[model samples]
Target: MKKCPNCSADVEEVFELCWNCNYSFSEQKVIEIKDYTIQEGNREVNCLRCDIPLIFSGRYDFHEGARLGAWGNLFELFVNSERFDLYMCPKCGKVEFFIPLNDSEYKKS
Candidate 1:
């Protein structure tokens, strides 16, 4: 593992970018980052661990037999192409799932 010169975080040898601080090893500088978190009306989302705004990663349709965990999907009836909003923390790579807040098409399971 190589230590990041900017943040002093240990990065894996094969990676060119530092995941913790967004430092580019080949360029020898920190990269500029933009916040692309899609904000919903009166509904703000943030990472619980990193406290950073979560970036919107588009909606997804989970089909039947999708393995979310050993116990299975969160909404059992969501197999019918109902979409869920996906958000992720850029720094920590933590992902979060949310039901669309402003969408009227969202159905209750």
Candidate 2:
């Protein structure tokens, strides 16, 4: 822990800016290592429209090919796939996504 120069509060060693005073520590090397072990697994979320628990489905990847036009290879951008949690509400006949495709469960299934 490092003491903030402006407010004298204890700031995290990895934090460059003091949380209390917002003092910028440009000279310091803040090493931020994110640990993914503690990340929570994907869980079911209720549908906003029907309040029904959503189901986890499979994942799909979408690749955008280069556009063949006058300016060749100008717009060769990659489009990310849309991961969706398939959910159906029998009460209201509503089908929607409970979670996005970037979620961990999307890759798992």
Candidate 3:
């Protein structure tokens, strides 16, 4: 166990930041990730690159801090950081990310 420098709270050695105070042990800060997955049922989605069926993975509501990552920068996370539906291709390892339809859209579908 390790003590946090800022809060003096006990933290596990495996983790760099203090879970209680969110203190950064390193120069980089930790980003918060929130999951907002909705059941889309068994929808058939295919990968464009490999032409293989995609598997429904999970969903997430990324915060502004996490939006600073590599792929996060590509999307307009700064302006619009909405919920995303994640899909993965088992063969080519391609990830398909898109915004899930809201309640109104779901009714239309």
CA lDDT of every candidate: 0.78, 0.56, 0.69
* Residue-wise C-alpha lDDT for candidate 3, range 31-100, written one tens digit per residue: 4634444456244679999888899887665545444567766555344345667899999899888767
Candidate that beats the other on TM-score, 1 or 2, i.e. the better one:
1
TM-score of candidate 3 to 2 decimals: 0.42
TM-scores for all candidates: the values are: 0.43, 0.31, 0.42
How many backbone collisions does model 1 have? 0
lDDT of 2 by residue, 1-109 (tens): 9897777889889978877756778854343544433222245557678788765443334445555687545553433344444555556666664335345545422
Ranking by lDDT: 1, 3, 2
Winner by lDDT: 1
Show where candidate 3 strays beyond 4 Å: 1-41, 66-80, 102-109
Q: State which candidate, 1 or 3, has the greater TM-score.
A: 1
Query: Residue 48 in candidate 1 has what lDDT?
Result: 96
lDDT string for model 1 (1-109, tens) is 9999999999999999999999999999999876544345224678999999888888776655565675565655555565678888899999988876566666654
**Which residue ranges in model 2 land beyond 4 Å of their true spot?**
1-41, 66-109
Ranking by TM-score: 1, 3, 2
